[model samples]
Structure formats: structure tokens, C-alpha cells
Target: MFTIEHDFDATVITLVDDPARHRQEDVTVNAFEDCVTLEQYDAQSDRVMRVTLSPAQVSDLAAALDLPEGVYKIGRKS
Candidate 1:
């Protein structure tokens, strides 16, 4: 399950492992105007881990998901 909320500075999206209990901490994504952040709990480190991506990186990631095997470069539109 997932939930979405629009805040003043960013859009927050949380992914739940189980909808019924809602106890398990799942992944969270925060999208801001300039960048995006993905966060999840790390069992080994006993802390939350986060990854930040720039706008360009996010665009490349979106395209990479639908792409077939092989390396490719993402080009910007003029």
C-alpha cells in the first residue's frame, strides 16, 4: 500500500509493507522542486538510509526503467 501527501515544499509518498497493521516501516520518497529523495530503514545500521537524486538523474532513472539491456545516454531536449 501507499500514501501520498502534498506539503508546502515537497510531495511525500510512503510505501507500506502491510496495510492492515501499518506497523512495518517501509520506503518513503520525497520529491522537491529541485531534487528527489528516497529513504528506507537499514536493519544493519539500525538507522534510516537516504539517497538523493537531482532532476537530471531522476529523468535518466525514469528512462532507464523502460530501457532494454545495454548502456545508453540520456539527452536533454532543447
Candidate 2:
């Protein structure tokens, strides 16, 4: 399951793991104008872990998801 909210500064998306998947904790993604942040709770560390990605990195990641197993670079459209 997932939920999305629009904040003043950013859009927040929370991803909840399915019970059938047997996964604990949820992932939260915050998309800001300048960058994107992915966050999740860490039971072992007793804290939340966050990863930030630049706009370019986020675009690359989106493109990468549709690709097969191979190295590739995204080129600008003319």
C-alpha cells in the first residue's frame, strides 16, 4: 500500500509493505524541488536512514528501471 501527500515544500510518499511479503517497516520518499530523499526505519540502528538523490540521479534511476541487465547511459534528446 502507498500514500501520497503534498506539503508546502515537497511531496511525501509513504510505501507500506504488504503483509504477504513479510516485510517490516515502511519507506518514505520526499520529493523536493532540488532533490529527492528516500527514508526508512532501521530497527537494528534504532533510527531512520535516509538517502538523497540529485535530480539527474533520480532521472537516471527512473530510466534504469525499464532497462534490462546491462550498463547504459541516458543521452539527451536532440
Candidate 3:
């Protein structure tokens, strides 16, 4: 399951794992103007872990989902 919310500075998207699936913590993605952040809880450390990505990296990641297994480079559209 997933949920989306629009905040003043960013758009927040939360991804919830299904009960039938493997037990995993939820992931929160925050999309900002300059960058995007992905966060998830770590049970071992008892803290939240966050990873920041640039716009280019986010674009590449989105493109990767539908692509075949191979190296790829994403270029900007005209």
C-alpha cells in the first residue's frame, strides 16, 4: 500500500509493506525542488536512515524500472 501527501516544501510518499509479504519497515520519500530523500526505519539501530538523491539520479532511477538488464544512461528530453 502507499499514500501520498503534499506538504508546503515537498511531496511525501509513504510505501507500506503488505502483511502477507516479508516484514519490513515502511519507506517515506520526500520530493523537494532541488532533491529527493528516501527514509526508512532501522530496527537494529533504532533510528531512521535517509538517503538523498539529486534530480538526475531520481530521473535515472525512474527510467531504470522499465528497462532491461544492462547499463544505461538517461538523457534529457528536448
Give the candidate number with the greatest TM-score: 3
In model 3, what lDDT does residue 22 have? 71
Give the higher-TM-score candidate: 1 or 2.
Answer: 2
Count clashing pairs, candidate 3.
Answer: 0
Tens digit per residue, CA lDDT, model 3, 1-78: 999999999999999998965779999999999999999999999999999999999999999999999999776876
Each prediction's Cα RMSD? 3.3, 1.9, 1.8
Per-candidate Cα lDDT values, in order, are 0.92, 0.95, 0.95
Prediction 1 global C-alpha lDDT: 0.92
> Tens digits of per-residue lDDT for model 2 on 1-29?
99999999999999999887669799999
lDDT tens digits, residues 1-78, model 1? 899999999999999887565466699999999999999998888999999999999999999999999999877886
Error of 3 at 40 (Å): 0.3
Candidate 1 has a TM-score of 0.83
Worst 10 residues of 3 by lDDT: 16-25
List, in order, the clash count of every candidate structure.
Answer: 0, 0, 0
**Residue 61, candidate 3: how far off, in angstroms?**
0.4
